[model samples]
Target: MGATMVEKILSSHALDRQLRAGDVVVASVDFAMVHDGRAGNALKMIEKMNAKALPFAHRAAFVVDHFSPPPNAEAANTHAAMRSFAAAHGARLYDVGSGICHQVLPEGGHFTCGDIVVGTDTHSTTYGAFNALGTGVEGTDLSAVLATGKAWFRVPETIRVELSGRLAPGVWAKDITLHMLRRLGAEGANYRALEYVGSAVEAMAIDDRMTLANHAAELGAKAAILEADAKTEAWLQAHGAAAPRPVRADADAHYAEVIGIDAGSLAPQVARPHHIDQAVSVAEAGTQRIDLALIGTCTNGRLDDLRQAAAVLRGKRIAPGVRMIVTPASRAIYLQALREGLIETLAQAGASVEPAGCGTCVGITGKLIAGDGEVIVSSANRNFKGRLGNPRAQIWIASSATVAASALTGVLTDPRGVAGGDWRVQ
Candidate 1:
């Protein structure tokens, strides 16, 4: 019985030398993160615990992202408290407009391969894109990590998802994850690890892999990881990160189940309102009207995502009666987009470009205040009822290209049908 990638990472972090699936261990966390949404509460709990110091303060990060710029007085106070706490504790603090924690952490080179990282955000699994074992934890659990730099886990069984073929035109990583959700449902990988494998996954860029790993939480996965390879090394080198020590699963590694997907067979996919698992092909979803089109979030707010949206929006105007919003995931990405004229392209298309943050995704600001039954086509993840603040406001999740194409037509239009540059499939 060879060790899986997850098993190897866990064993390295675990106090027990022979950690395995179903075994309990207190693993050391290399890095921990807390976002504004949960920072105040986590701080309070840490105070209650009377922790004098955090063992990993240098590696810990506090981000003021959700509800950035302070939507209201209450949120402002929370952000202030978080800022004060971070400063006093010597933990790295990313102020409002810095970016979402998930994006900022990796973009800042805080994450490295083979590290066991945990955060207060479910999307913390985004770090898995670097081949690190990242998982989300509750506030209490995070407080424990803050106090002692350790947390417990029951090693999860691994599910090998082998992707084959190449993505077709206008389709992207977002569609791939949505297709998986449609096949596996919401709880498909509950309490399990999803190990992405195969040629298609290997061909995916680091940003694309982040998109897949970020959605693992929606599938109820404990963690979603990819084997570190040359692409990973290239990304790390470009970021000036240390030379990578890649982690690989043994050839005979045991998997609870193996699933294969042909990426070439996939089309643009959309998740209907109220549940992420209720996904259907864009054509099958029909031409539904939309009031807003959002083109950014931690899931799809990287530079490449913005470029894709820009390609569709350049030299075009957004549809009448539709408000389009584009938010970069980080300050770095925002600046890069500006340098490339992506920001101007979106603005010229009648889209409102907001600061880098999780605008509207958590419903703190930029929310839809439309009539009942209004629809929004968003690139952000999660389309649950009232996720964007109004229970009556419906959300349709799709790729940035799809969102931009639909923004031009005020309906669910596929990018392939629109006037856009050739699709750049990875």
Candidate 2:
């Protein structure tokens, strides 16, 4: 049988040059990343292991995000330690305000096709948008990679997700991911690799692909990758990255399973509180009153996402008694939004634009929804109970456009209702 993309990449990096599903191999890592949340723990492990130096310091990055600006003295000390560790080990350290690690890594041209990149964050799979093998690891695993420049992996069976047709108006990659979550429960793809294929996926922009790949982990996927093509090359080129080496599965590649989806059949999807798989259509979800609306995160904080939100909030203002927050994923995206006046537009609409970082996505910092039974519509990935820092508060996950539209009326308003014309303030 012809080799799948995952098999090809694994075999190429494996010592034996032969790999199959469930086969364990020690492969060299192309890049490794850690954010402030896990950096202190990883550093402690390295010290405990008595590591003299990292074998691939140049390829490792330490990002001070997720609580950017230090919410407290303890966080400040942790950031200081991470910075010291990065400087001493010669690893690149992106200080506070640099943006989320996943966004910064790719925006800075550290990821490319066919590379094996790992991060201490579960959303590390975001890198797979570029056709790279990205996986999240624990602190112990990260420490081993840092000490030896290699890590072991059991080659995951590949599940081919074939996409056909384009998304309908008002729907987005976030909705698609949420739809998949609803179909395939939380553990559906456990220890498996989700390989997105077909015309619809190929037609999607890199940012959209990132949204799909970022949430694969929520389905228990070990990794999710898209086949690199011309669009991938164009995005890399536009970002000043070197020419990428595209990788594709062989024509006769074997897959564990094949699932087909018609993107045109999908509509706006929302994930209710306490579980990402608790998804329902906007109509089924009804008009949920919201006290806060958030419009950014690693999943949907790129320029395109911000622009879409800005387009909706242009002439309208957020509803009374509702607070809205917008955060860019990276410094570069923030600058671009500023140049395009997206910041002013959001502020004029009563949305507070915070610095580029994780913000309230990780429940680290931001004006979180207070009081029991409070509701928030956020574009971030997860909406589990207490995910936004209050167990009493509920979160509903949707696309940036949906969040923006909902912010206008302080309820779960569908973006389609506001698209194609000026939004009337109630």
Candidate 3:
């Protein structure tokens, strides 16, 4: 193969050639990172293997994010298991009561760009935001990697995603990603390596870029990567990362398909039941209104996103009938929002603020009543069937701005049209 960017990167660290699909290639793993709930499962898998020694014992990492502080007894058990696992195996851990696994790893300078890393959670793909060939695998796969510093894989074909223009006002990286699933369907990107590019891409922040890549699995993608540049470098530097230069895809990189999107024309998008591709514009999905509004998650939980929500709800209150919920992605974001008074703004607007974790996004903690008593506008990833607490109550997806605006008006409205080039005290 002449090799695309992914191929080049893989080849540079390849242990073999002609590693086709269905063939297990035990390539070296540059890193292995795990999170709270997943680490317990990975620990069980490692025990099953009866492994005595680790290939990269010190390189193994365990991070506690989901229920780290213990929202309940089960969560407490999970946290204890992780800490015990870290201690027993001499594994590195980031249990400083800080951010989620994805946010903390890159911020803590664990894996660098071009490192082929894997984790036990799907969102491990978040590392791809920094141009690492990072992806998620089973706990068993991670256990094998822990034992051998290598894992099996069959090379997946590549799909190119080309963003055509600047996003319109109120449309964020999350909007484009949700809308992409709308067109491509959940299974469309299955078993393929995804490459995202173009101008709209350039305008996105590392957090948003991560949100897009992390959601690739929602479409069944093997892995998704954004072409890295100076912005990526700056983000890594700001987060204290000293990543190596990433290999950029050639201008004419080989892709199974080139998908184009004109982001400037895109409105806030939402996905309906059962599949991510069931997405529609907030206006089209408008009649299916909402009763709850939530902001923040690994997908849309950045400082800028909170500011957008605050901007939209600066002076207004959420509709009396609707209950808005806010959860930041990290303890750092919580402190930042607290200092900025975004938490106060949301609370003042009748919103309920939860801890800094992935609580409501995936219907994990803030699960709703399973019937039609509520509809929601959430800034979470994947609005699939039974995804947001209710298989009956409809859930719409949008940016923090649109979610906030919808929460205020109790109806879906184009926030860009409402706010224009600036945030207003609406």
Candidate 4:
């Protein structure tokens, strides 16, 4: 049988061997990253390994996010260490406000199509949107790659997710992801690779594609990849990456399972508190009251996402009692939004714009804590208990449009009501 997309990537990166699902291989890493949360630990690991020098330092990156501006002295020290380490080793450092690791790496043109990329953050799967095989690794694993430029992996079996039809107005990639989470459960695709294909996926913009791949981790995916076509080439080139050498799976490639989704049938989906899989249509979620509305994260903090929210909030202010926070994923996205007046629109709507970083999504910075008996609707990924730094406050996950509409009304509101005109980013 022919190899799947992930298998093809692994075999290409491996040494003189044809890798298949279930086969273990030591592959060269094209790019590796460690964020502020894990950089200190990874540095300690490298020291523990007694490495005199970092041979592949140029291929690694250390990002200061999660605690971007240094919430406390401890976080400040961690940032200091990361800066020192990156400078000494000749590695790249994305300082505070640079953005989330996932967003910065791609924007910096660190990796390209068919490359094997790994990061210390779970959402490393986000890079798969570029047709690269990206996955998350522990700090120890990151240290090894930093030292040796190689990491081992077991080729995961592939799951074919075929998409058809287009999403309805105000129904975004986030809604589709939430629908998948509901269908697949939390770990339905555990240790497997998800290969997204078909007309609907091809029609998606790079931002939407990133959103889908980023959330594949919530399905317990080991890696997530999509077809590399003209869109992929243009995005990589625009970001300063080298010319693409895209790869595709054989038509008859073996897959563990094949699941299909009709995007036209999907609606604005909301994942109830403490569980991403507890998803339901916005209408079915009822008019749940919300005290906080967060509109940014690696998952939905791109320029398009901000524009979508701005479209809903233009000439309108958020509810009287609701507090809203809008964070851009990176400085580049932030600047672009500024040029487009998205920042001004959102701010005028009573949404506070924080520095570009993980911000309230990771709960390390930003005064996003929810008080007792309060409810939150966020555009970030993951809504587990205490995910927003408070176990007492409930969190709900939805699309940026949904979050913006809900913030306008102080409850869970379907975005289709007000997000139809001039919402899509051209």
Best by TM-score: 4
Candidate 4 TM-score versus the reference: 0.98
Give lDDT for model 1: 0.87
Collision count of model 1: 0
Q: Which candidate is the best by lDDT?
A: 4
lDDT of 2 by residue, 230-298 (tens): 878777777766567677888888899999999989888889998899999888898689998997878
Alpha-carbon runs more than 4 Å astray in model 1: 364-369
| Residue 310 alpha-carbon offset, candidate 4, angstroms | 0.5
Q: Which residue pairs show collisions in model 2?
A: none
Tell me the tens digit of each residue's lDDT in model 1 across 26-78: 99888899998888788878877777777666678999889788878888898
* TM-score of every candidate: 0.97, 0.96, 0.92, 0.98
lDDT values of the candidates?
Answer: 0.87, 0.85, 0.75, 0.89
Minimal lDDT window, size 10, model 2: 417-426
For candidate 3, write residues 102-171 as lDDT tens digits.
7767767777777787887777777888888877887888888888888766777788888988876677
- On lDDT, who's better, 1 or 4? 4
Q: What's the distance in Å from true for residue 59, model 4?
A: 0.4
Give the clashing pairs for model 4. Answer: none
Report the poorest 10 consecutive residues by lDDT, candidate 3.
417-426
Is 2 or 3 the stronger prediction by TM-score?
2
Evaluated at residue 328, the lDDT of candidate 1 is 95
